[model samples]
Target: MNNIENIRPLISVIMPAYNAENYIEDAINSVLSQSYEEWELIIIDDCSSDKTLKIAEKLSNNDSRLKLIKNSKNIGVSETRNKAINLALGEWIAFLDSDDLWENAKLEKQIAHANKVGASFVFTGSSYINKEGKPFKGVFEVPESVDFNKLKRQNVIPCSSVLVRKECFETIRMERDNMHEDYAAWLRILKSGILAFGVNEPLLVYRLSVSSKSGNKFKTIGMNYRVFRSIEMNPVSSVYFAGVNLVNSLKKYNKILFKNKKIKRLRLTNPL
Candidate 1:
């Protein structure tokens, strides 16, 4: 027989939230529904003006595993996440945006994979969900493994789907104030000679809100370029990598659009 109390938590989830009242509850519920029970969720409210903090507080009261941390002022997402990471107690740290969700088996499967291969960092595939919580067309499929060179061209790792060993951050932490800071952090990890593995299953449902920074495609492009140049410190390398990122991004969305069109055409022709 297995002893529940004897087993220490393997993962600590970090969620940095600001003005997430509309969908934050759903995100919390997703964690509550996880099949893996030995984990902790630390939700930091970044001085949200809305009911985001209140909701998180209410949920935390019901479960000891769920913790709520409120910021004194509106620190950005990067700082909020870093604070939570610094306080994390589990051997592994996982990220989940306040508005995104995970399938019940996500932690269970990812932890097994990590133990099997001894990977320091791992991410899974993710699909988009619209404001209405309906499945969208864009689905990100990542390669099996990524190194510094492969990641430089295109950052296919989704922050929300990642599970990283706690010690990996000993040398590098998330850049507190930068566009695409998560991308910069991942690049730093890979550059340090750590191999990141990707599980090909879509274990995350990333919410696409129009008001979000990443929802603005043009702004994201500029941010990607800035991240490469400013952090990577090579204008020529930045341009080459930025170009590859742009082209790959276009192909990803175009493929989604094409699939939607083909489905619509089939529906019209078959009257189904």
Candidate 2:
């Protein structure tokens, strides 16, 4: 069953860019530095007024593995990603947002784990980074496996940390600009009884921006409720799960903040 071609399956990485000129180069560089070689990166510029397209163009010119496209109009992230998905060539699909960074061996480890466990959907644990690229205090660890029932309450899979089979998107695609598109899509996929495996190591580093909706806990909770609603969840149940999600999310952030405070105190006392 394994041949030279089968030995190294191609992976198409979908990256959607919108005014990400500042970090686009670093994001693309991370993909270029991956230990996995059989991968093609498709970067679609979402009509950014910034220099994102020019920078990606320069990189794509240097490497033939990159496929670059620019939208004629401003399409939202959900649609932008879907457009890139339509052009993907590999059976494997990986996502890396323009602003997020991946560890050098990210794809290598993820694919190795997938083959070992026969996992169709995979996500890695991640740590958060500030806009200036400083590491955060705590890591967001993921369990070995999560089922629909567990994921229904809260989504542990980060969009940039996901690696799924291309065929999985045949039915479901990210939508709903106002809500959490990726979360909704994951819920639908897992609802079909597909179990998602997690790589606990922090292979993905997510960038936290003050302007992003995810930075606002209250707004994200509302978005979580909307995600439940998109899946036809009852209002009462959605509210219940949303509340539970809020508490869990707050606990995680609080833990990170506490660790940060501890480190600051130690620095102050020891004069490090």
Candidate 3:
């Protein structure tokens, strides 16, 4: 055993898995490969009928640090993640989706940055990886430090790339019906006067699959409308956010249509 291992602070990684057999291993491996060695992987299986639960159980059995929790009934991602967070024993909490992955030095780098900057919460840039496992070149850029004013304009933080102090959960509660739970939680935290800092490094790979919940435009638009309405504000700001959300939804629809056309052309040529 190494001497440094004994002094390392415990980092609890909360992962909510649901029918993610194909990508779960990669997700687990990403955490296992982290340069920061003292961490626990808390995987909550949301009653997946697929091999996801079995695989998670196997991994937990192999590693003492990997803790597996099974839900008796199928709950949504928000509930599953909240349960995992409640069960975590670490001083710091990090979220990783079963279909996404982190770079090897992600935890170490982020922890160092947080400690140096004295930030309670930290998020990093991430590259988008398509279903075929090809990573896109562009990275999502967010403000280095967020305030309520900045967050109201846009939600640039990605949940899978976030690392926050465990105490943050005491103030921000996850909404079960909110499709973008991270954004909602961040807004709540910001409203409470806590500023979240961002790391510019692309330390995570956010997987984008055709079947992803966010891929549904109509559902996302509906959810955004709900989010705008949920915020405690005057009628004027509410209308402003609603209009901003509508334009954002239309932009996404246009991008999706263009991508679909390109995909159709490729299919015609390759016949795959």
Q: Which candidate number has the best lDDT?
A: 2
Worst 10 residues of 2 by lDDT: 263-272
Mind giving the per-residue lDDT tens digits that candidate 3 earns over 1-272?
Answer: 54543446789999999899988988999999999988999999999989998988888898899999999998888888889889999989999989889999998988887877878889997766766677644565556888877776666677888899899898566775555666778788888888889888879888764443444545555565556566666666766765565565355334434645534211100000
lDDT of each: 0.80, 0.84, 0.76
Which model scores highest in TM-score?
2
Task: Provide the lDDT at 152 for model 1.
Answer: 79
TM-score of each: 0.88, 0.91, 0.84
Candidate 3's C-alpha runs over 4 A off are 1-7, 211-218, 234-236, 245-272
lDDT of 1 at 95: 93
Off by over 4 Å in 2: 1-6, 210-215, 262-272
lDDT by residue for model 1 (162-197), tens: 999999887777764547788888888888889999
Question: Between prediction 2 and prediction 3, which has the larger lDDT?
Answer: 2
Q: What is candidate 2's TM-score against the reference? A: 0.91
Q: List the residue pairs that clash in candidate 1.
A: none
Candidate 1 accuracy as TM-score: 0.88
- Which of candidates 1 and 2 reaches a greater lDDT? 2
How high a TM-score does candidate 3 get? Answer: 0.84
Q: Lowest-lDDT window of 10 residues in candidate 1? A: 263-272
